[model samples]
Target chain A: MAEITLKSLAHSYSKNPAEPQDYAIREMNHVWHQGGAYALLGPSGCGKSTMLNIISGLLEPSNGEVLFDGKVVNSLPPEERNIAQVFQFPVIYDTMTVYDNLAFPLRNMKTPEARVHERVMEVADVLELTSQLKRKAKNLSADEKQKVSMGRGLVRDDVSAILFDEPLTVIDPQLKWKLRRKLKEIHHRFRITMVYVTHDQLEASTFADMIAVMYEGQVVQFGTPRELFETPNHTFVGYFIGSPGMNFLDVTVRDGKVFSGEAQLLVDNRVHDGIARATSDNVKLGIRPEFIEVHQEPVEDGMEVKVEHAQDLGTYSIVYASLGGISLKARVEEDQITPVDKAWLRFPSEKIGLYVDDYRVELPHE
Target chain B: MNKVYNNRAWWLILPMLLLVAFSAIIPLMTVVNYSVQDVFDAHTRFFTGTEWFVKMLNDPMLQGALLRQFAFSLTILAIEVPLGIGIALLMPKRGWQASVVLILVTMPLLIPWNVVGSIWQLFTRGDIGLMGWSLRELGYGYNITASPVDAWATIILMDVWHWTPLIALLCYSGLRSIPDAYYQAARIDRASKWSVFRYIQLPKLTNVLVIGVLLRFMHSFMIYAEPFVLTGGGPGSSTTFLSQSLTTMAIGQQDLGPSAAFSLIYFLIILLVTWVFYTAIMNMQKDDNKGA
Candidate 1:
């Protein structure tokens, strides 16, 4: 495995760069350390795959350089870049036997026949496909075929990184869990640098050591899952990183005080001071669904809210409604029942996050 | 079993089955009737029970035509199958540009068959055709109209232009149906261009190529309009094929009985060959699709 660095990279589909905003992937800089597990997470059409392709040398950036271990490799083809990638669907050769499909890449590299056989056998063993080695690929189940695809990439130990682009999306739900755990096991054992791309928050948060949340062709935040969940650098990150996502409410602040609609909020002056510098006074308050507890009566530091709807999800309930004209959601215990008309909600100061213009206003711990 | 009654599906197939019987079965019955009888005055016909068939078996002209038919079918398939696959491999995969290129390539196939024959006839003519004129200018004697060598060249060239596009179109559809994931995986595997084609593209193309071969073979076996209009089985009948020979006997020479027998033999040959090709292709695909 080798470290990968992207230096001031920017790309656009147009020829002349058109305007200052005519970029599919905007300029930014980041480094992926060797043996680190990272993910590029985003919604559909958010340029995550484009960024992944650029890193794999499938597309050249209009203005920037890609360096592998401090050596420039922007001009190298994907093969020369020593990166292995798995696509959304299984892509093994239909006519070849399972053994042959795993052996193809090694054979192309002119690896010794004996060693190639050994490598393929080892991979098949790891994948639990030893019994099906002599069988043709077309007859296998979709999950089995995809396993062969993964085997093809992992057969070569010299490859610097293995890139996965929603590879588990086509897998059956039960198989997705098993394959993901297998991949994690493979990464832990091999210590290979891996970059996975997906729109699923759970997959990214669970698999990657660091998750890069992208929105509108730019990375909004890059941090550990806990960090992203607790202190999202941008409002988009808050909305994207959790189940049922995070609840957001607009609050206007003036004279070191926060106001949600007409109801005033009690926030520390130090927290208000950092937000005061960001110009836009239309501040946003963010809280995870888990943090906003639902109660029968308005508790201390709690706001009275109307419960619009309640979703039953076996163990917990999600109360969807608005608070002070802004939509917010609160997670409640499944056994507790709140009237559909109105309920009291609590937002603890420790769990409340403040943002200005979709970006978090970093708070002082004190 | 009695859950649903979809009688509307019956209405959909009634028209189709009636059309097939009217257009195909009735005419076939007529041929069968003619094959076993000797008609004196349409009403005074006598049952002749395999008499014409026996005579056709001894006819040297029918044998020659049959030989020529297989040879021409094989030659056309050899040229068109691989050429179609090669062109398909080079076709652009996406965008409006692909649509534009596809239309241009399919334009030849869309032309009327007789017109295509006439166009190629002029294009291969000794004095006026561009190919002939260019060949002569290059110090080679070429005259497809009266010379056997020229006649064969013209027929081969005409068949290639008219049919290669059909194969290419089929192959293009087959190639396009392949998902992008395959190519991406190939890239990651670092497969060479040849390995990608052999292990991926060619294996994937076998099913369609079987269709290409069968279709080309059947069409070339009965190919009449172009060669008949261009060569008229001339150049000492070197270009005479089965359908042309049948036409010569039935229409030109007015030998109705022999022609009827000859047509039955020709139809049987095509059916037998097609069955064999179909069986082989199906077996191979089944194995390929299930072996793993």
Candidate 2:
């Protein structure tokens, strides 16, 4: 296994790119540590696949170096780099049996047939494909075909890493779960550096120890699932990660106090100072819906708002409310009294995030 | 529950039956009628009872033409399939060059069959043709009218030139339909170029190749216009194929009964061979399924 590093890597499909928008992947530096499970997560056209292709040596970057184990492998082809990639759709040799499909990479390396058999059997056993060894790959189901493609990678022992480009896309939802579990098992057993590229947050969170969330051809944040949820570095991350996402209200600083129109927000002194020091006019207050407290009765220090509606989601209810024309959502527990047409809302100081120019501003620690 | 039958639905198929009869069955029945009887005139006829079929089948001249027809069809198929695939492989994948090459490759196929024959005939004229004059200048006697080997070679080369483009176009379309992901996967697998073709490309091309092969086989088996215009079955009938022989018997010599019988045999041979090819390919797929 090897640590794969992208050093200021950038790529543009155009012959002469004149603007940052032309680049599929903007200049950035990132690393997948040796034997680490990482996911490159983003929305469609967000350069996640482009970054994966650059790492696999399938597409040469227009600029910067891809270093493997501290050695620059910028000029090496995918085969020479000893990297395996499973594409979005399953790609297997239609004429070959599953056994032969698994043995293909080994055979290409001129590995001995005896060892090839051993490796194929081992991978097949792990994938629960032992009974399908003799069957033609083309005759198998979609998920099985995907497994065979993954097996083609697992059969080779010399591969430094296995890259997956949404390899479970063609699979059914139930099979997607099983195959994901199987992949997790493989990563744990083989300890190979695996980088999965997907547009799904749950897939990334479940499959990767660390997720590099990309936005507009740039990696906006790289952190653990919990860290991304609790402390998103960019506004896009905050809006894109959690269900219903984080609620934000455009605010302005006046005398070291944050105001959403005419009413002043009662926030911590650190947030007040952070807003006072912010130079941009794009200052906003962000808070997760889950952390917002909603009470049917007005209390001291609580902001009164018009409750639009509440959606019962079994264990918890999401109350959609409006405060002086600004809309917000708050997740209230089922045991709590449901809010009526009006309710009191409170933004917990510890859970509140202050944003300036669409980026979270770190508040001074107490 | 009891099922009910609708007899009125039978009337719904009358139009299709009439269309089929007018387009196919009526014409085929005329040939069958002629084959089964010796028609001296429209009103006067005698029952032949397979007598003409026996005579036509035993005719040595017809037998020689039949053998030559199979040899020509098999030879041209063997040459065209591989050459077409090779051309497709060497073709540019995109850009203006790909369009230019496609236009150039399709030029021969666009020409009328008789026009192709006339073009080759002038192209190989001993007195003034480029190939024939060049061979004569080099002190080599390359006369299609005088030598059977030269005549056969010229006809085979002409057929290959005229038809290899169809196969190439089919194979090219087939190759284009395969996604880039297969190639990327093969590259990651470290597969050699030959292995890529053998495992990925050839398997994907099988469907198109089947269509190309069957079309070329049927077209070549019914060869008439080119050889008819160029050689007229000369050089002691060395390049005479079954269609030309049937044409000579039916239209030239006016042996309607025997020619009709020969036509039936010719039709059956093509149908039988095509069936065999189709079944062989389908059975191969069935075996793969059984293995699964």
Candidate 3:
């Protein structure tokens, strides 16, 4: 296994890219540590797949280098790079049996038949494809086919990394979880440097120890699931990580107070000082819906909001409220009283994130 | 829910039945009528039973032509299928070059059968044609009208030139339909170029190749125009295929009784051989352990 490093790597499909908009992957440097289970997470068309392809050596970056274990491997082709990739759709040789499909990569390397058989049996056992070994790969179900494809990657002992590009997309919902658990089990057992590319946050968070959140061709934040939820480094990360996302409101700092629209927002002096020294006028206050406390009765320093509606979602309820003409969502536990029509929302200072130009700003105190 | 048994719904198929009868059955019946009878005129006819059929089947000349037809069909198929696949492999996958190559490759298929024969006729003329004159100049005695071997070789080459494009186009479209991910996965698997073609491309092209082989077989089996135009069934009828022989007997000599019998035999041979080919290819596709 090898640590993959992207050093100032960038890519553009255009022959001559004049502006940053032309880039599919904007210039960035990132490192995936050796034997790390990492996920490149983003929405559709966010360049996560492009980054994965670059790391796998399927794509050559237009600028900068891709280093594997401190060696520049930009000139190497995918086959020479010793990497395996599972595509979005399962790609199996239709005529080959599951045994042959798993043995394909090993056979290509001219591995002896005895060892090939041993490896094939081992991988098939892990994928629970032992019974299917004699059957043609094309006859298997979609999830089984995906497992065979993954088994093809795992059979080769020399492979330094395995890149998955949304491999669970075609699987049935019930089997997706099983296959995901199978992948986790495999990762724990083998410890090959695995990079899973996915648009689903839950899949990424569950499968990856660290997720690199991509936004508009750039990796905005790389952190653990808890870290991303607690302190998102970028506004896009905050908005993308949690369900119903983080609530954002445009605010301005006047003297030592913060006001969103015409209504004054209660903020600690640390936030007020950070906003006061902000270089840009594009300032936003961000807070997760789960962190916001909703009260039916007005409490001290609580901002009054017009509760438009509340959705009772079994375990918890989401309060959709408007404060000073800005929409906000607050999550309330099922045991708590549901707020309706009008409610008071409290934003704890520790949970509040100040943003300037779509980037999180650190308050002076912490 | 109770099942509705509608007897009247069967009448809705009458139009298709009438169409099939008019298009196929009636014409076949006319041929059968002529085959079993000595029709002196439209009105005056004598029942011949299987006399014409026995005579036609036992004829030495007809037997020779049948054997020659099988050889020709098999030979052309063997040449065209692999050559077509190779051309498809070399073809550009996309861009303006792909369009240009496609149009160029399709040019031969668009020419009429007679026109293709005429083109080859002029092309292989011993005195003036490019190929014939070049062979002559290069000290090779290449006379299609004199030597049977030259005539047979020339006919095979002409057929290959005229029809390999159909197979190539079919295989090209089949190749294009395969997604790019397969290639990427193959690369990641460290598969050799030949391994990729053998495992990925050839298996995917099986469906189209089946169609291509069957079409080429049927077309080549009934081929009359091209060889007839170029060689005229000589070098002593060396290149005389079944269709040319049938045309000579039925139209030129006007042997109505025996020719009609031969026509039926010809139709059955094509039907039987095509059925065998189709069944064999389809059987190859089924799972080995599962007998169908």
Candidate 4:
């Protein structure tokens, strides 16, 4: 395993790279520690996959350097970089047997025949592909094909890192869970620097220890999955990293509390009013769906919202509600049978976030 | 009634069946008639009982033509298939550029076979044609009309130029159908360029290459026009192939009985050879699929 550092690495498909806005991936700096299971998480077109491709040497940055093990690999091809990548779809050699497909890379590298067979059988056993070893790959199902794709990547232990770009996209729902569990086990056993790229919050959270939240060509925040879920550093992150997503309500901050126009709420005394000094008076309050407690009565000093629709999804019910002429959503426990029209909403103050123009506010002191 | 009729759909095929019978059965009957009889005039014929077939069986011209046909087919196949695949491998994979390149490659296939022959005929002449002049300038004694080697090379070159595009286009289509994910998988496997081509690209191209081999083989075996125009069976009959021999028997010499007998033999050769090729390719494909 090896540590990868991206130093001011920027890229733009267009020549001249005329402006900061011209970059497909903007200037960024981060060191992915050795043996760390990290994820590049973002919406489509956010340059998360672009960054992964760059790290793998499939693409070169227009500027700066990508240092793997403290040596710049900007000029190296993906093979020279000694990294394995699993794509969104299974890419197997359909003309070869499944065993041969897994054995191909090792054979190409001229590994001893005995070792090649042993390594292939070992990985196949791990993936439960031993039964299909002699079977022609053309007749295998799609999920099986993807396992071969993965097995080919995992076969080479000399590779410093293994990267995956939404490798579960084509898997059947039942198989996807099993594969994810298998991948997590493999990562733990191998301790390779695995960088997984996905836009799914649940998959990212469950698979990756560190989730790097990306927005518009920038690494907005990189932290553990739980940290991202609990304290999202950006408005986009808060909204993106949840199933029903976070609810955002435009509010005005006054005194030591934030007001949702006459419905006042209090929070922990942190994030110095330096947030208010940011030149924008328009502030938005962000809260996870699970954090907002819904009640039947006026509930004395809680915010109010009109419930539009409630979706009962077995384990939990998500309520689509509106407040102050803006739509908001709240995910509550399945036990809460919320009525339509009127409901008392309590935004658990300590868990709430404030963003001015999509930028999150950081508390000055605890 | 419609559902019941679906089970008896051969009723809908009666006219087509009659059409096929009239075209195929009538000609076959006439050929058989000519093959076994002696004909002095269109209306006056006598049963000769395999007399022409016996004579055709021993004909030196038929033997030479068959040999020439095989040589021409093998030579053209060897030249065209690899050339076509190479060009395809080098062609761009996407965008308007790929379309433009496709059109350029398709241009040669669009040229009429007769026109292709005529064009090569003019282009291989001694005095003014660029090929002859260029070869002479380069100090090679080259004259396609008079030399068998020159004739053979010109025929091979002409066939390659005309038919290589077909193979390349088929290969290009096969290449394009490959998903990007496969390449990604190869990349992650840290596969080398040669390994990727050997294991991935070549295997993917096998089906298209088989199609190309069959097509080019059939077309080259029956080739008459280009070499006919360029060499005209001169230089003591070096460029003469089966079609020319068949035409010489039926039309030029007007030996109807002998021609009819020879035609059946020629048809059998092509049918047998094509069957062999088809069966061999299918067997290989099946084995590969099972092993894969």
Candidate 5:
């Protein structure tokens, strides 16, 4: 296993890129620690797959060096790099039997027959494809074909990492979860560096120990699921990570007071200093919907909000409301009494995050 | 439980039945009638009762033509299939070069069969053609009319030049349909170029190749126009294929009964061979499916 490092990696599909927007992957340096299960998570066209391809040597970075275990392998082809990649759709050899499909890589390297057989059988067992070992890959179901594709990667012992580019896209929902768990098990058992690329937050969080949430061709935040939920590094992450997402309100600081459409927010001294020190005119206040406390009557330092919609979501209802003409969502328990027209909303000081220019501004710890 | 038997759908097939009968069945019946009778004139005919069929089957001339037809078809297939696949493999996968190469390759296929024959005829003439003059300049006698080997080689080459593009075009479409992921996966697996072609490219090209082989076989088996024009089936019937022999008996001379018998046999042979080729390819697919 080897750590994958990108040093100022940037790629542009255009031949002569004049502006930063031309680059599919904007310049950045990042490290995927050896044996760590990490995900390059983002929306479509955000360049997660581009980064994965760069690490796998399927693509050479346009501007920077790609290092594997601290050695620059920028010019190396994928075959010479010893990295395995499972594609979005199932790509098993149609003519080969499942057994032979699993054994293909090892056979290409001329691995001994006995060792190939042992490894193939082990992977087949893990993937629950033992019964289909004799069957042609073309005849297997989509998920089984995907498993066979994954098994090809697992069978090779010398691979530095196994990269997945949305490998579950073609699989059924039930089989997707099972195969993901199987992949996680394989990662743990082998201790190989696995980089899963997906636009789905749930898939990334469940499959990767560290999810690198990407936005607009850059990694906005790299943290655990809980860390991303509690403390999103960028406004994009705050908007992307949770269901219904974090509610952001445009605010202006005047005489050490934060005003969002004339509704003054109660905050600690640190936030007040942060707002005052912020240089960008696009200053905003952010808070997760889960942290917003809603009450029928106004409390101390509470702001009134109009209740537009309250959806009953079985376990918890998402209450959509507007404070000072700005829309916000709050997740309330099923038994929580929601008012028809209005409610008092409180943004907890501890959870309140101040932002300037969509980037999180550091608030001094109280 | 009574079923509604709508007779209206049966009327819809009436037009199809009439077309098939007019185009196929009526002509076929007339040939069958001639095969069983010795016809001096349209109005004056005598029932022969398999006499023409027995005589024609025993004729050594027809047998030689049958054997030569097999050899020629097999030779052309042997040369064309592999050569076509090789040309397709060497072709550029994309860009303006690919488009230019596709247009150039498809040039020969656009020519009519008679025109293809006329083109090859002049191209292989010792006095006027570049190829024949070059061969003669190299101290070789390359006369299609005199040498059986030259006649065979020139006709085979002409057929290959004219038709290999069909195979190549089919294969090119087949190759293009294969996703780039297979190649990337092959690279990741460290597959050799030969392994990639054998396991990935060849397997994917099988469907198209089957079509190419069957079409080429059927087209080549009825080899009349090109050989008749280029060599005139000369060098003492060296390249006189089944169709030329049938034409000679049926149209050139007025031996209707024997020629009709020969025509039926020729049709049956083509049908049988095509069936065999199609069945073999299909059974191989079935094995891959493994009762899926």
Candidate 6:
């Protein structure tokens, strides 16, 4: 296994990129630790697959270097780099049996027949494909064919990494969890460095120890799931990670007080000072819906919000409210009594984040 | 679930049945009727059951022609299939060059079949043609009229020249349909060029190859124009194929009863061979084992 490093890497499909928007991957420096399960998470066309392709050596970055274990491999092809990649669709030799499909990579390397058989059997067992070993790959279900593709990667002992580009897209919803758990089990057992690229937040958070949330051809945040949930470094991350996503309210500074319109928000003095010192007029306050406390009566440090709707979602209810003419969502416990028309809302000091020009500002936590 | 009985669909199929009868069944029945009778004229005919079939089957000239037809069909198929696949592999994949090459390769296919025969007949003339003149200048006695070997060779060459492009076009489309992911995956697996062709490309092209083989077999079996024009069944009947021999019997000599029998036999032979070819190809796709 190898730790992959991208040093000032940038890619553009255009021959001469004159602007930042032309590049598929913006110039950045990042490293994946050896044998770590990491996910590159983003929406469609956000460059997650582009980054994965760069690391796999299937694509050469237009600018900088990709070093595997601290050796420059930008010129090397995927075969020389010893990387295995599973694509969005399952790619198997249609005429080959499941046993042969799993054995393909090792056989290509001229591994001895005895060891090829052993490794193929081992991987097939792990994938629960033992009974299908004699069956042709084309006749199998979509998910089974994908497992055989993954098995081709796992059967090779000399592979440095396995890259997956949304490999579970064709699988049924109920089977997706089973396949995901199988992947986690395989990672723990073999300790292979796997970089999974996907657009699903739950899949990324569950599959990887850390996620690199990408936005507009750049990785905006790289952190653990909890860290991303609690402190998103970029506003895009704040909006992209959570289920309902963090609520962002546009604010302005007037006389060292942060105001949404005419009413002042209860934030710490450091935020107010930061707003006062900020040069850009674009400022926003971000807070997760789960952290917002809903009180039936007006209390100190709480602002009265008009209740638009309350949705009871089995475990908890989401209260859609308007605070000073700005729409907000606050998650409340199911046991709590529903507020009629007006409810008092409070944003926790530790959960509130200040932003200037679409990036989170570093404010002292209370 | 209870089934709904709807017989109106039978009415919907009547037009197709009438079309098939006019197009296929009626003509075939007329041939069958001619095959079973000895006719002096349209008014005077005698029912001679199985006599014409027995006479046509026992004719040694017809038997020799049938053998030659099989040899020619198999020979052309063997040469064209692999050659077409190779040409497709070598062809440029994209850009202006691809379009130009595609146009050039498909040029021969668009020519009328009779025109192709006429062109080759003139082109292979030993006294005036460039190819024959050049070969004669090189001190080789390459005459299609005198040597049976030369006659057979020229006819096969003319057919190959005219028809290999169809196979190439089919294979080119098949090659283009393969996604880039398979090649990428093959590279990642460290597969050699030959292994990639054997495992990936060849297997994926099986459907197209079946089409190419069946079409070439049937077309080559019925081939008459090219060989008839180029060789004219020359060199003492060495290159006389089934269709030319049948035409000589039916039209040249006007022996209607035995010629009709021969025509039915020839039709059955093509149908039988085509069915065999299709079945063999489709059987290769079946899985060896079915599991629970």
Q: Please say which candidate is ahead in DockQ: 5 or 6.
A: 6
Clashes of each: 3, 0, 0, 3, 0, 0
- Deviation from native of the Cα of residue B37 in model 3, angstroms: 2.3
Highest DockQ: give the candidate number: 6
Chain B TM, every candidate: 0.89, 0.97, 0.97, 0.90, 0.95, 0.97
lDDT of 6 by residue, B7-64 (tens): 9978999999999999999999988999999999979999999999999999999999
Q: Mind giving the per-residue lDDT tens digits that candidate 4 earns over B23-131? A: 8988888888888888999799899887888898788878888888898899888888778888999999889998899999999999988899888877876678788
| Candidate 4 lDDT by residue in tens digits, A1-366 | 799999998889898878878898998898999999888899999998889899998898998999999999999988788899989888888678899999988987889999999999999998999988988887888999999989988998888898999999999989889999999999989899999999988888889899999988999889998888888888889879878777776776587665566655544455325345557866777889888888878875566778989988889888888776667788778677766888878766677777888878865554
Which portions of model 4 miss their true places by more than 4 Å? A253-278, A363-366, B1-6, B14-55, B92-107, B137-139, B180-190, B287-292
Model 3 pairs in collision: none
Q: Put down candidate 2 lDDT per residue, B25-97, tens digits, no spaces.
A: 9999989999999999879999998998999889999999999999999999999999999999999999999
> Relative to the unseen true structure, what is the C-alpha lDDT of residue A232 in candidate 2, on a scale of 0 to 100?
88
Candidate number with the higher TM-score (1 or 2): 2
- TM-scores for all predictions: 0.93, 0.97, 0.97, 0.90, 0.96, 0.97
The segments of candidate 5 whose C-alpha lies over 4 angstroms from its true place after superposition are A262-269, B1-11, B288-292
Interface RMSD of each: 2.9, 1.9, 2.9, 3.2, 2.3, 1.1
True contacts kept of 2: 0.79
Q: In candidate 1, how many Å is residue A193 off?
A: 1.3
- Least well predicted 10-residue stretch by lDDT in candidate 3 chain A: A249-258
Q: Is the docking of candidate 4 incorrect, acceptable, medium or high quality?
A: medium
Residue A249, model 3: Cα distance from true site in angstroms? 0.5
Give the residue spans of candidate 2 off by over 4 A: A262-264, B1-7, B288-292
Using DockQ as the yardstick, the better of models 2 and 6 is 6
DockQ of each: 0.59, 0.69, 0.58, 0.50, 0.56, 0.75
Q: For residues A1-366, could you state the per-residue lDDT of candidate 6 as single tens digits?
A: 899998999999899999999999999999999999999999999898888888888898899999999999999999999998999999999989999999889988889999999999999999999999999888999999999999998999778999999999999999999999999999999999999999999999999999999999999999999989999998899899887899998888887777987777877787777677677988888999999989998887898999999888989989999977889999988889878799998887778888888888887533
Question: Residue A183, candidate 2: how far off, in angstroms?
Answer: 0.7
Residue B269 CA error for candidate 1 (Å)? 1.3
Per-candidate alpha-carbon RMSD to the true structure: 2.8, 1.6, 1.7, 3.4, 2.1, 1.7
